[model samples]
Target chain A: MTEQLVLNYSIAGDDFTKAGEAAADFKTVLKKTGVPPDIIRRAAICMYEGEINMVIHADGGDAEIIIGADKIEIILADRGPGIPDIELAMQEGYTTAPENIRSLGFGAGMGLPNMKRYSDGFDIKSAPGVGTTVKMTIMLPKNRE
Target chain B: MKIREISEILGAEVLCCHELLDTDVHSACGCDLMSDVLAFVKDQSVLLTGLVNLQSIRTADMMDMKCIVFVRGKKPDDAMLNLAVERGIVLLSSPLRMYIACGRLYSAGLAGMSEE
Candidate 1:
């Protein structure tokens, strides 16, 4: 059978108020595609976390969502100061975000962790000064890990 | 317990979704960090935090939570209230701090999701 549909988005990093716009739109797309609530939730968590990363670190980037029959894949690519230490960044409590970001309910260093936790597939590629890109996938039913 | 019961327990004033006061939330979590909320919370329970911002309501909506109780007399602004109304979530403000409010609810049998 042919794939259901594909969704693409470009996130804006200019304003913090609009950080979740793309993710929220992705969520709407998922809802319209007949994804279950729990699966939609998994997708939402991953996309929102990635969206936040794009805003907080990358100053904005692009997100492409490929919604297939078996799974949904969200590839988020950003050009920001890449992580010097992926290991430390993956740690639960580690965060380099400024104090002001913490006031906004982010910078908890849990973004990547939560993304990994909610996603069936999580992979990250980064270079210290180049940029960072994260790919997270959520599978439905038997497609899930 | 129901959201209304919890509101009464904390003497909190409902800021939005007054109609949802009867919604049942069996668990509660207290945290100022939205990251911790994402890392730990589950099952659409109540969120107790002192953080006053749009992200707080957004976090609750993302978690599929039923209600948010702002402790330490933290009052939410118009943006936050508007978001709560849009999401159909119960938003309340309590004069109690984070620890005391969570403790009171815990002692009254509102268990954490992880504890169960």
Candidate 2:
């Protein structure tokens, strides 16, 4: 617990079926680290939503997770078309994902909002043509120490 | 209620994790949208959805749900079943539609997610 554990994953964008694998893998790792189940669930939800967004909107992305003693940080960065209006994108039920995605049980416009809801710290940086980067941090429970 | 009772109530076929059917689930959520399920659901151990895809399984796994009932006779494909097996999530295919399935479960004492 003294050293930070860093994990990196490359999310494949073309396959919708594989979207949450990274988050699932990370969830296992977190469980093995003895993190509380509630904290693990929150971190898993945040990463899963971010992974879905990267696949649905961005082509693909890199997810970097840093697990420290007091907090878990998730950084998702994608080199795809970025959001034009972060404000609008943050609103619930305001997704731009197409019909196919909705049919697959996503794109309800709750991704970003859900990520923010479960994370203790949330931030996003996007440029219309460049790409987007999202950083979310979940604080571990005080009792974990 | 236990997952076995849920399967019996909905006339659902247990697709995987049959050994876990005796697991108890206190609350449930019925939704087709994974995002909404992830956003609104809290500590709900059962998910009833018509959406048949891998994301449904993944969402349930993320929420730490124990069982997923595919309503409206929807069946999950092999890949999804395999994933559910790995995640230890019980998969059920029910003939009942979304509304009837939810109502039946609620009537059977399975509560929905609490309004927060």
Candidate 3:
């Protein structure tokens, strides 16, 4: 467990049903590494929220997870239409997700906020037509505390 | 409350992970919005929702929830059930609507999430 562990995943946007697979798999990995339960939960929630956003808004994306001794880092990058206003998008109750996605119990305007809430460090970069990338880090507990 | 008791109170049918019914749950939340459900964090909690999509299961898993009760006779698809089984999350189908189901669980001593 001394070395960094890196995992990459290509998320599919065409299928809404498969949205959370990457997050679920990453959770399993974190559990196997014996990370603290709370830290693992936070990391998984961040990843899951990012994955859902990638599927719903970004069309699809690439997820890169780096597991280190002291922290877990997740980078989700997408090539879909980027957010025009990061401030507004980060607001707790603002969402641009379509009605169809809303019907499926998503697009509550909480995805980004939730991700930021659960992570120790959060950053987002998006351009009007370029794409969006989100980086989140969750600090792991030392001495298993 | 133990999941079994919650099941009994709601008259819910176990959809998956029957063996985990004996697990204890301290708090519960009923919401179709996954993000709202994610705002509160608790140990050994239960999620009661009418949302039957995979995100429901995923949300429960993310928050370390022990069980999910699909209200209003809503049933989860096989994929959702499989994910629940894989995550070791108990799934239940209850005939009661969200409001009544939460009321029944609350009356039965299952508390909601504490304000942070």
Candidate 4:
């Protein structure tokens, strides 16, 4: 028996302050749905980072979250300058963001790393000049109750 | 240490949550980098940062921080204050800079980031 919920959101560009609103809203829904706190936190962090990435680089993007009985899947698609080097981007402390973003308390190059850290499975698909799509899965420990 | 004590020690202005000033906080983390706070700091009820932005409050809320102290006389604007009020998080600003404010609290027994 499988139960699933899929959520879709459009992350707006140019509003850095409003970036985390979607994740916060999801946390509320997750709480109402009786998901474990740890599992909610993992999904929150992953989506929050992806939200920031969308605003910072792609100017905007689309996010889809599929919640399953055993796992949560997050897919973020952005129409921006695609990642030229996945390996370089994955390296902690390496970022292409400007200093202005750093002043905003981000761009320390931990976004991707943190997403990977909080998620159980991670996948990336991108092509330069076209776009990038990041997929992440976080498994819920069944015995969390 | 309680937030009220921190205010007394530094003579800082309580920008918001005056009623909640007596809330006790066992630990504090001082950092301008929100990512560091997210990645490293945990369970610290109070956060001291020079950065002033809406995201600052959001980050603190995400971490379940109870209070945010803006060091170096940095003041939060209306937007940040509104959000803090909604989240019931105290907001304070002190002219004592990051070092002196942190030291005063440390001497008073509030554990620093690593200790937290």
lDDT of each: 0.84, 0.93, 0.90, 0.86
Writing each residue's lDDT as its tens digit, candidate 2 over B1-116 gives: 89999999999999999999999999999998888898874789999999888999999999999999999888888999999999999999999999999999999899999785
- Please tell me which predicted candidate would have the highest TM-score against the true structure: 2
Best by DockQ: 2
Per-residue lDDT for A63-126 in model 1, tens only?
A: 9888887888899988889999898899877888878888888998899999999999999999
Model 2 lDDT tens row, A1-145: 6679999999999999999999999999999887989889999999999999999999989999999988999999999899999999999889899999989998889999999999999999999999999999999865464
Instruction: Give the Cα error of residue B1 in candidate 1, in Å.
Output: 1.4
lDDT of 2 at B74: 88
- Docking class for model 4 is medium
lDDT for model 2: 0.93
Leading candidate by lDDT: 2
Question: Model 3 off-target regions past 4 Å?
Answer: none
Tell me the docking grade of candidate 2: high
lDDT score at residue A99, model 4, on the 0-100 scale: 94
- RMSD of model 2 against the true structure: 1.1
lDDT score of model 3?
A: 0.90
DockQ (C-alpha based) per candidate is 0.64, 0.94, 0.81, 0.65
lDDT of 3 at B36: 85
Residue-by-residue lDDT tens digits, candidate 1, B1-88: 9999999889899888999999888888888888788776468489999888877887787778889999988888888788788778
Cα distance off (Å), candidate 4, residue A78: 0.7
Q: Cα RMSD (Å) between model 3 and the true structure?
A: 1.3
Q: Each candidate's TM vs. the true structure?
A: 0.91, 0.97, 0.96, 0.91
